[model samples]
Target: MDKYTGKRLDGRYEIHELIGSGGMALVYRAYDEIDDRTVAIKILKDEFLGNEEFIRRFKNESKAIAVLSHPNIVKVYDVSFGDRIQYIVEEYIDGITLKEYLDQQKEVKWKEAIHFTIQILRALQHAHEKGIVHRDIKPQNIMLLQDGTIKVTDFGIARFSRSETRTMTDKAIGSVHYIAPEQARGDLTDEKADIYSVGVMLYEMITGQLPFEADSAVSVAIMQLQADPKPPKEINPNIPDGLEEITLKAMQKNPVQRYQSAAEMLRDIEEFRRNPSIRFQYKYFIDEKPTKYIDAINTVKGTEQPVYNDNYEYEEEPVRNPKKKKKSTASLVITGIAAAFLIVAVGFGLAALLHSCSSGPQDVPLPNFVGHNYDDVKNNPAYKNFKFITETKNDSSQKAGTILGQNPKAGTVVKSNSDVTLTINAGGKMVTIPDLTNKTQDEAVSNLQQLNLTYDVLPVEDANVTKGYVQNTDPPAGTQVAEGSKVSVYVSTGSGGEKVAVPAIIDETLDAAKKDIAAAGLTVGKITTKDDTGKPKDTVIETTPLPGVQVAKGSSVSIVVSSGNKSEKSIDIFVHLPKNVTHDINLKAYLGNELQTEKTVNPSYNDVCQLTFTGTSGKKQLTIQLDGNKYQVYTLDFDAGTFKQDESYPYTENSSASESVSGPITPAD
Candidate 1:
């Protein structure tokens, strides 16, 4: 048996059994005696009690969870630090980790993936806004309930975002496969790092595979640093293009290129949820520079050669005469003057040609084309000299083929035949609304998103349909609605029955109370029994919401039952002091061999110290000891508040002393 299975901590929480174990802690399913409810206690592992690093992480987890209170985030109820143990009490979640769910179903549907991702993002969004960053985020840290709710868990490594000088260890901290590049590289991390992990999880959910995986964690970390995975659509063609874009965009290698915050990523996700087919024109900038290639021959010493011109021919001549040199100089001067005149004449002719081309046509003013059709503008005789470039976009507010915008504003001067870019509206894409009646809210949402449409959900009390399912949608099924159009979806809020007051069931039999509760349109929830004086055994003592409280028609009502009045009894514990003792001595009392209390007394002033204990009636063993030595043992009948001698021991000094008290010992007030 586990040491703590039957133990009570701080005289309150009773540990039942170990439910989970991690690197630094052990989680137990415990009951809070004070609160009368089940809670999960995460106790630091015995081996880590003395380890400072583990202790810090254990406390960090408690502090991190304590500050966050979101529907999708696990909640911390209490924290305790003791000499031998440290533990945190958190809400007991009855569910499996998302990792287990993924393992059971390797490939999750895209719509289901989005549902989980949205909850995770919301949790992160809340944590980030509070200046906390969950340095570790993965499916293993997410809890999935049966009702399709998600609770993010495990913030052991979370850090405060405002701590500018904080830095992680050189070794990678988070799970290698889902870690961001900056995290893997041991660089400063922020909210964008969590976004990257979410993207990886989305990829795995839709593609049934991790973006980067290798045989070892180090190899995977390396892959995260330098490798790029194939787009999710390649593995799962059913994944929508826009979702793929969002996923890859979040996984960008550069932190700045990824979503700057969880809210930013959530916006993209919401946009995708509204219009799955809506494509995002996300552009990433890459710096590039021109390169010049030089010939290797230009660097070789012996390869250098003199330049030769075909236009001037040279002839070798034997020693030239002085007279001939003078004649040649005069001839060269005359040739240079004639060449300069020829060059001037050519320049003048070229300038005259350029002026004629520049004056061929006057600059034309750009005409307004925002409201005109592209075809009419393209074929207009007056604008025939201009070159038109067209781009099409879907716009519900404009007619098909209508020009929506132009490059230059109207009245601007532009050269004739210059390029003019026009943005033309291609008309809104019409999509048929799928039948949503009887479908769950999530399913209905997925259907609408697949058609690039938005939805406004209105929850109304419904008698026929189940809660959270779509009752009906406005505009009806089969209607051809334009993309991005809002569809009003009516969601069922369960049966709309009349509210009924809970009747008093105190002091009634358990069976009778259950029947009365059921007749009042309520169901019995958790039933607990406690000792009470006013009620008999098996009688209902009270209800969770109390009597006369209003509740929904079919809501569950928890009742406390009586286990009969407890029999009270008292015991006198006596301890004999040694004559040789001169300093203060301590006397300890035990009931059922468990320490109840201890008292310190000066042995010089008194020889005998007495203590009394009162508790539930039962046959119990009473043991009293002095200075860590066994003194006496007795069988106490707590029902009769009496006792009989079981065993006795003499003082070590060989002195005779009374081991049993003749009368009841009065407990100190």
Candidate 2:
């Protein structure tokens, strides 16, 4: 098992098992205690923690997805880019990757392929419109749910089209077999490149083979740049003509000939879906030879018919009689002379009209531009006579790119061609700060960047918080701040107290782990038992504050030992008591019918009491009594280490019966 398999991160994501691994990250199936849901966490591999390039790529994926919210795209809930570890928490997908499915079945039906392609295209359309390009669009990055839904994921190599222009590497950035010709040539790529990759995937699905194959990736890249893929029909004759046309059009070697945008491609797919037999018959003349015109007698017209020239424009044949042609030419010259004189007269009239208005430039009232898109207003033909002098300011209250203020106020008469200054809102919008506690400096900064916010990191000595991780943020999390706001992030140095690394106790016997903890100058806190079929009884399977985490010496370390697949597991629950009771009360806690804890407590002395509950790893009912009157009913989650006060009853001093109540009870201290 991996070291993180049974560990918890940030005290919220409980890593259960390693589900998948990629080139630079490992994916784990974890349970989110705070959200009470299962999530998939992708952690950057330990080897690349110090590699800046890999870290950038890892951060890029989260940044790319943070701005995109589509049904066919994976959702990112959290991210942590600590110095030692980096991870992204995303929605758990209970499905297989498209690559895995393709491996199981070499080829998919054409209709099924189209269905999948449509979803992928929809996802790309959303990303493209947001100025994002998923350079890597291959089967490996596509997830297929059991219900036939397609999810596009893995944006590690994605690029923002508006801000970024060139590729980071000299070689191709994506899979060689699926990348566009321009990508293989190391040319600047855009949304069209993603369309090409989608086309390649469609080809593989329909033909059950790659378009180009060679001994090495470099050779395959060459093929992508120069080779023409065999038509899908040749490999699979059942492919619809229109579908084939769409695929080939998308796979065109030149970007100009390919689908301009994902939306444009979707329209073609929609047309085909409406009518399967429809044929676009799109023609390309780039590779064809010049057309040859053969001489033939014109049956309808005794004179030779007009012939097409190299430019595809029509030209009349030369006349055979010179005298007749000369007469015609002279007539044409006379008409040309008359036309030239008419043009000169018209030009003089226009010049006179312009001279009349030359005294003063044409003037028009300046129209209101505030609350309108600056680009729309600037590009409007009505405003063409005026030159716009644009300035931008960060105003989170207004929509980005919208005109916030205009000089030469609306209704003011401004001369034509006059420079009008317009102030546009540059800040995107306001965003609520997400919980940044326990996140590392890099992770917090990345999150701030995603929201268009800036940050300053402050390293403070804190013993309660992990070293190198965020202890808190200025204004705290959940505060709604405008975009571009500077937030100060406080990071823990773990130096306020003498710190010791939590000794590795996973897989060790409970007695052995206890001895290790004692040797490390830490006392054993609580030992919880979980039913793990993979481990032997009494073997430690997990630990609190995880191994290698630095904590103050003498601090209590908790361990979770395996019960060896027992029918039931042991759990600990904390029962709250009223601390201001004037007299002693009999406090009894019952887990179902079994009495777990029975004690006489003076509420003024003890504010809380601990109770042990035995049950399987699921919700269990707990009944607590105050002086024989049912005080509260609680539901406990053993696996998540959480509980909810389902029902509460008010207990008055010397009251004979329990009074019904609402909400949770607070321990009066």
Candidate 3:
């Protein structure tokens, strides 16, 4: 690795020092002599280069990203092989590893975690747009730049990602803490897997602990494949409930259950930040056994025991005392005492047994379930032995406690040998309602306010629903809640979601135009260069559909910019014109265009101009051309009386240019 360091690599990049070492390769900080920038060079370990499969996968993913020039993703600079060194050059980012940052902080602040998560989402969203998925998303592969932006790296280096460009197939066992369930199960990993991994990372960030841990890597991996760790709230109850829900949703064990895309994750995080009380979680029991719960209840219910005194034997009157044997009077006295003792013992025992039963059942044991809901776990007849009142309410928002509502609550005494009933908290009922009326839009959403109602603010075209007025409800007004309830209120979504037309970007520099395009929800595509149109070539000049046209979200617009260059040779120029037309041609043309003109070519009035052309007396060809290529040919029988005043040329059509060529030609004016 050092041999290539400090020298030109691939005859262009000047190798520098060893930056880091990964499982498959060693990275070096290098300088691109041609591009004149620092880059991270990753060279496959010498031994692994021999493995053709690994070599293929390594090259394919790298190439996948080389074309992905996204703001949040590390840019792949170049890829090449020489001297048994298969190296990939990427954008050199100066920053700390997300893992290192997490380790140093030990616990990321909620705001910081959210901000970091947002960056990751943006990166993933960008990847998804390009049809790529970063399967191994983890803290180690993320870098927090000095300026605090997160750069998602190492995506193109995963072994399990089966991107079409992958070159190798290896037994892929990802890091235990970050591997998604599907990957563990040897299922095809996709965007969902990456979403799960990000969720795990966020969990670790806020809780300062991995969701699951075991003695061996394999064990941890297995747990991830099959189990969910205790909810984030359990680890750090201080974490906002909303954030926990987002985390759980992201880490859902089933791919179908997890977030489908990074954009969705971003939306959830934003929602959670807005309201942390809403968390998504499910309960699970230890070893998934029903008996574990029944046994727990035994201690409280005391029903499993057939009888407390069954093991004891009652032996009445042990043949008086030795003294009684000598004296018949002593025997009589011992009998009287024994009879009294028996009477007292029997009376107290019977009374106590009756009291215990009358006081209600004993408290039942707490069933061990981490993420289940009440209705789901309730009614296991095994719980009948405990003495506890059951209360089940709509708490769809909360993971149902295995013993939904336990008597003795968590730890209380049951009337020994009694029956207990538990009322569990059920997840809230689902509903769709009419609009909220008269109340402020914000205040109108009484649906989810815990009165067995949950209402969402619906967007409607209206002048109503001012801050306090209810627009409308699903079930009209006065609908009952807590049972079969759902309401939607149309709030005054005033002046929102208005579409904006993409502006002309042809002549503007790439950087300047990119910012505007992205802000408008438009993407830049196919950047190439052509010789100057006399404007600052390569600069944006014009875009499609003119400007100010209202369009929907994520519209694709093309920018025709100046190349800021001039063709070295004057090639065949063709004039594209209507055939068999002769008229006064006052063609004031421009051969070389300017950048300012191109940038605002169609910006407004006075920005349009013609290309350079000459209306000379050339009877030989009588042809006009533009751009020196893509030409049109015509035979003009110029019968104009005046050279300057006469625009009409007695142009007769030549059969045409080469039949193979399909282009327009006309008289040169």
The per-prediction CA RMSD against the true structure, in angstroms, equals 31.6, 30.2, 32.1
CA lDDT of each candidate?
0.74, 0.76, 0.57
Off by over 4 Å in 3: 82-84, 156-171, 275-669
Q: Tell how far residue 438 is off in model 3, in angstroms.
A: 82
Clashing pairs in 1: none
For 1-669, candidate 1 gives per-residue lDDT tens digits of 346777999999999756666777878889999999899999997656765566777887887888899999988988999979899999988666788777765346787899999999999999998888897899999988756789999998887777544544334577878888777655677888999999999889989999997776656766787777898878986676788889999899889899998888889989767544456879987646332211110112245342211111111222322442222345877879976997688655754564464536669999998999776676454676677888877898776678999998788899887889999886689788899999988899998988878777666555668988888888899997667667878787665564555666766799999999998889999999876343578887656665655567788888888878775655565455677677765556677757776767677898767667787677787776554545667666665454555655654321222234322232235
List the candidate 2 regions with Cα displacement exceeding 4 Å.
Answer: 288-669
Which of candidates 1 and 3 reaches a greater lDDT?
1
Models 1 onward score TM values of 0.44, 0.44, 0.41
RMSD, candidate 3, Å: 32.1
Which residue pairs does candidate 2 place in steric collision? Answer: none
What would you estimate as the lDDT of candidate 3? 0.57
lDDT of 2: 0.76
Question: Candidate 1 at residue 141, lDDT?
Answer: 94
